[model samples]
Target: MKAYPITTRYIKRGEDFIPIIIDAIRNSGIKLEDGDFIVLSEKMVSTAEGNFVDESKFEPGILAYFCYYWSKYLWGYALGKLLNIKEEKIKNLRKLPKKETLRHKETVIRTVGLRYALKPYAEGGLDLTNVPGTYVSPLPKDPKKWAERLYNEVKKEFGVDVVVMVADTDATYRIFKWYITALPYAINGIISGIGVLGFLLGRLAEIFKVGGFAGCTPLAIAGNKVYKNYSIDQFVRIAFICDRVHNTIKNINEVLEKYNSYVITEEILEKLKHTPVVVVKIKEEYIPNR
Candidate 1:
């Protein structure tokens, strides 16, 4: 399989994503063909759809405060021991900033639910890694529809029929053929929700053998005949390869620090080549058996 990262200008809210994707493909100089898969970061889609929350506008409730304190001070050790989380991460959890952490937790509870707000980061696929301060991107409301739309739009504009997969950077755990993730919503037959409890159980299951953090979560897939029989492991492996190529910068902080800006300003984004879309070529021989 061959993967090509398509670089383009930064995407903004309410902007038409199909055009941006077309521009990226043109600039990358890679011609699309039948059976090709287009992998897009969920953040890119969310941002384009204006699916984000500004934490400053919301008030932290009592439940949010309690959960934050318990996770940081008490629950961290228990979960750490159970899941074999790194000592460094456990220690960092204990030192979470009070004000900001509360705000984040409150936002999570309000948006997704308490079950999801309990996770450490990327709760219910609500991500803060790529966005600026006080701003978090929520998972697309209708990922399947988004995938279908993108697939149809690509076919209309480029005249090439291809599969579209929207994915998240969050790692999914695998136990044999079963894929488990802590995300609140279900995707591609993977079990979700149960939050930190799911992480613990998945790790415990791994102790038996052949299970652990696999790769990026495949949130939605549309088009293509081969994908119908794809296993969770296959989705993860391909998604990981696609994610590594699409990320131009390491994290949002790096971009902020580079430009000395609070948010992802137009100037900073314009200065860097952003690769949000990736073309993945899948050979028939490379498709893993279900």
Candidate 2:
């Protein structure tokens, strides 16, 4: 159950993740055991795959309208309420320049769409929270394949079986109700009637005094469980902190420091300074046994 942070070597635009993972494991001195697991943040994989999209590339169209109104009003509002997004920012969301506004708005839609259409298991907070610019990215296409590849690679290099898990920082909840409507892909993985159900259930969980982080902690655990045995060449989506799904992974630093007391060493910082990847150990509870 040891959670190891593998900071990748600053991966190039098209660099594959296999080698970066290998380097991280090697540098961290994490000798894998038969039951050991590797938890990978999907953002790292998305960056490796160049899954990002420039908001500037979007053209004014129906899709833009959907983002501007539907996402901003629905998903954004709900999350803003939960995360306490600044009122000023929420207000400003409505007055964005046509194109930038559309891109940001559409980013929400596309995020929601991916959640619903592609991975029903993904959660909300998939929108742009942390990145260098105005761009959004979705979960990788073949997590199972990527997981398999990483598993094989780690096994070959280290002579120990390691489960590969692709994770995001989004929070998730259980389905509280059923729906018969279609959601936009922009909001695909980020919002849905399913999420609405989860949201409601989250509220109920609170009222009932259930122990949870608004149902997100359990959902992240489920993502890890579901992908425990995915294809060797595929990436297995795994445990994530619901709060990490924001505009960037930068904020993760603070969360990591809060939950994990391991100091960021000078060597680690130096490596991270030059590489998109980093390597460190998180507390064991965050790691999955499978």
Q: Tally clashing residue pairs in candidate 2.
A: 57
User: Which one is best on lDDT?
Assistant: 1
For 1-290, candidate 1 gives per-residue lDDT tens digits of 87878876778765768877876686777888888999988878888788989988889999889879877866467866566776766776776767777888999889888877777655778877566556888887777887888889888878988989998877788877778888776575788866766666667777766788787788889986768777778788888888888756554445545775445544555577777888998873445459
State the lDDT at 77 in candidate 2: 62
RMSD of each: 4.1, 9.3
The superposed Cα distance between candidate 2 and the true structure at residue 286, in angstroms, equals 9.9
TM-score of 1: 0.85
Where does model 1 exceed 4 Å of error? 75-78, 86-88, 248-273, 284-290
Per residue, candidate 2 scores C-alpha lDDT tens digits across 86-142 of 475455444434555555545544555433322111233342423335555566555
The lDDT of each candidate is 0.77, 0.44
What lDDT, from 0 to 1, does candidate 1 have?
0.77
Best by TM-score: 1
Model 2 reaches what TM-score against the true structure? 0.57
